[model samples]
Target: MHRFANPTRFLRLAAAVLPFSAAVAALCLGAGLVWGLFFAPPDYQQGDTVRIMFIHVPSAMMAMGVYAGMAISSAIALIWRHAIADLIAKASAPIGATFTFICLLTGSLWGKPMWGTWWVWDARLTSMLIMLFIYLGYMALWQAFDDQTKAARAAAILALVGAINLPVIKFSVEWWNTLHQPASLITMEGPKIHESLLWPLLLMIVGFGAYYLTVLIFRVRAEIHQRRTRMLRMAQADRHNAMQAAD
Candidate 1:
């Protein structure tokens, strides 16, 4: 991990991996959507409404998974002062937030038909909503500070604290009565769903993972360049100040 601390090395690695990740993401996501929507057998009860699960489930998984990544990165940055780790946490926040939003939106769309309402304060739903707010708060903290170091520290602390919510979101269905169903695919007994529907859902999840990695690499590279440009400007300013003082 420390080997990746060098921006140049990390950028080279990212460049090598980006094209493959982008291609796999596009192919898998397109194929998964097509398979799930048109070919997969629909739920006997929910019928076509079940098609929404392909998008909703993948987004929901990525939403929590990305936050978990941020929390781990935050821990690395705080403990080891890994520069790339801090940037990763920063880069992941907005993407995680986007997936969280998508999860909420699609969940609501799915709920209207099954639950007879577009919204509910069920434990699972409410906990997921809180997770979304936590992502927003983490991003907002970065913008609130002028000092990058201070901001990163503050954001890291918040991320570590916010990680407590992940488990709450995960187990909310079990801890309390909720309209949301319990885990079907990831149970101790293995997936309860039939193989026909499961394969496409798995493909969508994989595609989303690839998509996140591709975006993260691009964002981190951009952030490194931005930091370098800022440092260069600051160096020029210091040189001008020294010259004026000598004069």
Candidate 2:
């Protein structure tokens, strides 16, 4: 972790691996979608509509996973003052929000066929909606401040607080009387889902994870460049002021 504290080193590493991650993400995501949509057997009860699960489940996993990552990054930023950590946390907001949105959208599409409604206030769904709002709020909090340090602190605090929702989202189906289905792929008793369906779903989740990493590296590099440009401008302004004073 400390090895990546140097932005230049991180940028070089990111550049080297960016293409590979991007390619893997695309290949896996495409193959998973094709396998899941075209080749996999349909659920006995849900029929072909069960195909939505391939996209919906992975997006839901990524939505929560990304927030967990943000909380970890924020913790590092606050405790260790790692500059890159703050940039990572900041860069993750939009991507996480996008995943959260995709989860909600795909879930809605799935629900309409399964639940006979376009939306529901089911515990899992409600908790996930709250998470979406949390992501948006964290991003808004960052923009609310003029000082980057203060913004980082505020956003990090929000991220830490909002992380409580992750558990709620995960357990909502079990803890409450909800329409949402409980975990089928992961269990103490082993996966209940058939191997035919499970493998493609796993592939999609891995693809999504890879996609997030690829985007994260690129966004962090952009943040570093933006910060450097800002610093350079400040320095130039300071020099001009000093020269005017000398005159």
Q: Give candidate 2 regions above 4 Å deviation.
A: 1-6, 164-192
Give the alpha carbon lDDT tens digit for every residue of 1-247 in model 2. Answer: 4123568777888999999999989988999999999999987777888788888888888988899899999999999988888999999999999999998898788778777788866555666788898899999999999888889988998898878656765576446633444533221113256789988999999999999999999898888888878877888999999999999
How much does each candidate deviate from the true structure in C-alpha RMSD? 4.2, 4.4
User: For model 1, how does the per-residue alpha-carbon lDDT over 144-197 read when each residue is reduced to its tens digit?
Assistant: 999888899999999998897567655864466434454332211132566899
Off by over 4 Å in 1: 1-5, 168-192
**Candidate of highest lDDT:** 1
Checking candidate 1 for backbone clashes, the offending pairs are: none
Candidate 1 lDDT score relative to the true structure: 0.85
lDDT score for candidate 2 against the true structure: 0.83
* TM-score per candidate, chains pooled: 0.89, 0.88
Span of 10 residues, lowest total lDDT, candidate 2: 182-191
The residue pairs that clash in candidate 2, if any, are none
